[model samples]
Target: MTCRIWGRISSINVRKVVFTAQLLDLTFERVDAGAAFGIVRTPQYQQRNPNSLVPLLEDGDFTLWESNVIVRYLCARHPERGLYPPELQARFDAERWMDWQQTTLNPAGREAFIQLIRTPAEQRNAQALAASVAATQPLLAMLDARLASRRFMAGDTLTMADIPIACEMHRWWGLPLEHAQHPNLRRWYDSIRSLPAASGALDVPLS
Candidate 1:
């Protein structure tokens, strides 16, 4: 049976799972939920996920939420696909960047997305948007420097680490900020965008 993923595609968190599913070539039924779709608040959805978040994954009887965890679970389920390495250090290395995306990059870039995309021009907070852009540059510069040595986030091949950060990059790049030129980061992001999964998930119209 195909796994079930509950989330709206426009969500960056939901894109993480959608990208992962495509990367792993797993058949999944992505039920529209959350935001404009409106099923996330229902009693049934809350039962599956108390936090009532999108990108919930259900494989048979096993259910998981939190976007990164769902990505990790999918990678683990398809270890031979090499998205998540089995070696302790390699796996953790990938995990660290994934956490960094959730902890640092996503939060830092969010205001820019909200202000530029979601907020109408007059109502947007300039200071918050500026601060958000400033906060995101260093995080991206760190990634740029890291990619100066590696083709992808972890080392060479694409891994679970790249998915969330890449989606975050999509968000950042989609915005109209005066981008800090991180050549290597741009190169790496361009490479990731070429992936089959990326074309549909990360390269879509930001909404």
Candidate 2:
């Protein structure tokens, strides 16, 4: 089935689904729909996704939203890649990291991204940016510690868990902040970022 993703690449959420789809080697069409692109507020788009969010996935007759869920769904379609992790424990372990990426890591870094990248320098909030950096650095260290023992989040092989976190790293690393060096996390990110499928998904300049 042909898949279509509605979102601009500039969006972290959209990048997550796009990266996952590309990593799975799925043929899909991407339509710009969020931010300056518009269309997300349209009646037709809202009918499919009430929240008017980007990265809405349309696979054949099935429509799914929420970036992480779309990633899991795409990975589920390609079991041979082993990105979805079949074992019970491994799957749940991957799920945990994916949830953490969205809940903890993304939120921690969001304010900084907005203030530094999205907001004008004259209008930026220094306190919010500092708070965001403060909250996110420990998480980066935690990830470094987690990766010190494994090549990937759930294990040695890349799984669904790595997709979102890698995208998060892509965003965090792209920022102009003076980030503490996360050797292990950097190692893991470099390896995945080098994958051929990551071309458009991970390499895009942050906006």
Candidate 3:
């Protein structure tokens, strides 16, 4: 049986899984959920993913949630694809960036996104927005330095690290901020943008 993904296209988390699936050439059906779609709270959906989050993966009898975990599973299942290396050290290196994204970048980015996108303009929290942007700069600088030295986050090869980070990067670049001097980050992002999967799955307007 074919795999199925439950999530809206506009969601960053869902975009990560969709992009990964596209990279692996895996055919899957995607169902809208979360925010505007109320299916996420349904009893059947709750049984599959109690968290009621976007990007739940259902492959045959197996089910999985968490976008990064889903990507890791897909890469592990298709080792020959080279998107997720089987080597322990290399995989660890890629995993490091993924962890960093979850722990460090996403929190900061989400705050900025919520203030700028989700919050009403009249009642938006400028102070909080400023703080979030300040917090994010150092992280972006770190990514810029890493990209300066290597073509991709996990060295020269594009691995799972690129997927999650790229999703965030789309938001970062799309936001109305003065262009910064992260040339390397910009170059790497542009390259990823050129990918067919990235274009199709990730190039959505920020919500």
Clashes within 3 Å, all models in order: 0, 0, 0
lDDT of all predictions, in order shown? 0.90, 0.93, 0.89
Between prediction 1 and prediction 3, which has the larger lDDT? Answer: 1
lDDT per residue for candidate 2 within 111-179, as digits (tens), equals 999998899999999999999999999999999999999999999999999999999999999999887
Clash pairs, model 1 backbone: none
- Measured with C-alpha atoms, the lDDT of residue 173 in candidate 2 is 92
Error of 2 at 155 (Å): 0.4
Instruction: State the displacement of the C-alpha of residue 33, model 1, in Å, after optimal TM-score superposition.
Output: 0.7
Per-candidate RMSD vs. true structure?
Answer: 0.9, 0.7, 1.0
What does the lDDT read for residue 17 in candidate 1? Answer: 95
Residue pairs in clash, model 3 = none
Residue 7, candidate 1: alpha-carbon lDDT? 93
Q: Which residue pairs clash within candidate 2? A: none
What's the CA error at residue 120 for candidate 3, in Å? 1.8
Model 1: residues with Cα > 4 Å off, grouped in runs: none
Task: Give a tens-digit lDDT track for model 1, residues 83-108.
Answer: 98889999999999999888888889
TM-score of each: 0.97, 0.98, 0.97
Minimal lDDT window, size 10, model 1: 195-204
